[model samples]
Target: MDPGANWWEALSAIGTVLAVLVSVAVAIREVARARAAESALEDERRQRLAEQRRGIAALVTAWAESQYEPSPDGTHYVRRVIAHVANESTEPAFNLNVVLAYGSPLIQLGPLSIPVPIHVLPARQARSWDVSPGFAAHSTGVGQVPTDPIASISFEDSRGVAWTRGYDGKLQEGGGHQAISPDSETGEAQIGPLDSPFNPIAVVTAFHSALESATTVQDLKPLLSPTATGWSALTNEELVALRDEHAAYGLAAHVWYPTPRIAYVRLIHDDDIERARKGDSARALVVTLVFLVGKGWRVFSSGGAVTEPDWIKFPRKDLLRDLRG
Candidate 1:
């Protein structure tokens, strides 16, 4: 073979090797570019999911606070909540669990420090988990865990009157007066004539009679003493308004006049009050009798009004005095 031909052959082989190397390099670059795009998409997806989770957390917090109210048994206030979790990945999450930390009023369950078992629904379906009737003693935190490993973790505080987390966590208050009880007679005596047989049962009966007799506001006027400042405060228009409002709301009076001095009656305007004492916004129209030097036990006062001290900013006793004057 000619030397020149051999040299040309060697050059052709080198050119072919170089073309192969160039092709391999191009393929590697394409793979790298695809991988980079995929990574960016994953990051974007994660960010969106995090944002959605945050929004859900906010909504859950609001729902919880709205439901929180004083228990009617007057023992405590309760807040209950349900949260929805979504599966963001293509693979189904298996045995998914949540870790909950109870900080202050929120106490953690022992051993696992894990959240209560939450039912796993389908990818788009939702599941619910109850956080409490949790007491006002502690704060709450929750974290989500998926069986398959992923890079995102977030947590939120579940305590506060409003939907934000931080030092604002306060104990929810009971609605009824702490001084009064369903069966309590002593506290009932303080408001009315102690010597009169105006206990809860008696007062309820008297109010019922008054309500039955009340064809007009004027007829009901006789049940209240002439000296009663509360009744006097009501204008004729206001009285008519009360009657109308009460009638619309199904207001009914029950008196428990056990003794002349102590009386207890519930003026139920709606069924809401029985569900929660906080709904007892309707005036109870209590009548208390106090003894005087010249007079024996008589109706000390009528149309009694009681409000939750926390909600009522003004001093009720002072207001009462001003009305009397």
Candidate 2:
């Protein structure tokens, strides 16, 4: 055999092997590029879906209106908070429920903070519901003072996607159905609780009886929880003011329970009837009694149109004068 012919065969074999290596490299690069494109498309799809979900929730809005008024039973004063929800989008919202939650430090009595479900909210229309019948103010012994009246709301958009609108008005996906209770009745959302361990009405009556019999502020100390806001370190001036208040109001005329753990005692004054006859029906003091888990029921707070001292920002003397009136 010729040596040059053998050399030619060797060169051809090298060329075939090089071509196979280049083909394999090209195929690998193509596969990597295809995978990167597919990943980018998947990310875009998820982002678009998220934006659509957020947009649907953003179209729903909620606000609240509140005022001090007599409770439904005409027994005691209560701060009635009405929640107004509106669906601005053309699509109706479904399973629209509102959960009135206390942030912290404020004790929720019974199931008062349960979800208030509104089956459906029509598009471009607004509806209002009283959400604060069993709500309590700042606990004299517990957490931060209650400020914002509005609570967190949840709903489902037309596409059946769950969404939550927080108290801060930010809309987010999921958490919409977390507030719904399995035991809720099939009809309208109820305002009051069905069961509790203690009777708040009887507790309030007993508290008032003890309050009326006390001859001095020191004697009244036992009627309050030891953890009450200023009850432990009450100044001499504060004691005198409380004594005068007790002397003027005497005892509660009527009592009502906003929850199984809270009672509102109506302390009608001497001239309250005359004031009411004159159309000034907001003159009496409403003492709040809260049931503590280990300590039972005690006076937690009090307020009136004239002597709402915590909210009035008035001097002590002026507050006492208004209390007497």
Candidate 3:
């Protein structure tokens, strides 16, 4: 009856089908495992790159001189920028280049085309380059590169991997990226953001401005904290008087944030230069202000007090401590 032949043939056919199915299932599992492994590798690469980026903390600062230079265009207040940079990093940076940026309200445009000379800085070392800002020639109004200017800088690690950072001059990290072009001569590689801080002179300038420009109590209100632990901003009358007296001000060297919300802005009364000498006249005073969250910078200290902590007594020592080498 050929029974044995049929039964054996059917069994053989079934075994072959089972073998092919098993092969396909195993191949599918292998493909999935490969994809999972590749995804893990990509994640690990990202982590390693982040660690590399953390090695470099390049900072640029805007240090305004006490004496304000008169710009040919009297409408603008121009000041010299002692653009300083330091490598607070673990590695050496070479072929380092710094460029001053110009734009209104950061994140709008990119960096300016003007490039400062390149230099080399090692870890923990700092170097200074001078730039005069607010000049209509170099910077364009809207207050010549807002108060917060981008000091776009780039450098290659000892290994030649290029990195770029856009320092907003206030120590806040702006745009930064890796895998930048290594060629310094080309016009292709440039700083990230071209935005500027509206007030370049920092809080003290802002304070002096509020004082100089305030004509009435209503005009002076925005610059002061009417209800604070230390209501120390200039009295409405004081602000009006300063404007009338042409009260010149020498911004204090340091703007310290005693607390995140509270900032201490110190200034020397230069209305009478000689009288403002260390012990002469009022000498110096501080205004403690509160930083209104998401609104703006520190609210003017309430009292309009003319005295500061022990720090202000020694201007040379406390001035520009944040930018110190």
Number of the top-ranking candidate, with TM-score as the measure: 2
Model 2, 25-44: lDDT tens digits are 99999989998989999999
Quality of model 2 by C-alpha lDDT? 0.56
Determine which window of 10 residues in candidate 2 has minimal summed lDDT: 186-195
Worst 10 residues of 1 by lDDT: 145-154
User: How high a TM-score does candidate 2 get?
Assistant: 0.43
Cα misplacement distance, residue 320 of candidate 1 (Å): 22
Q: Rate the local accuracy (lDDT) of all candidates.
A: 0.36, 0.56, 0.46
Against the true structure, candidate 3 reaches a TM-score of 0.34
RMSD of candidate 3 to the truth, in angstroms, is 20.0
The number of clashing residue pairs in each candidate reads 42, 1, 16
Ranking by lDDT: 2, 3, 1
Predicted model with the maximum lDDT: 2
TM-score of each: 0.25, 0.43, 0.34
What is the lDDT for 206 in model 2?
54
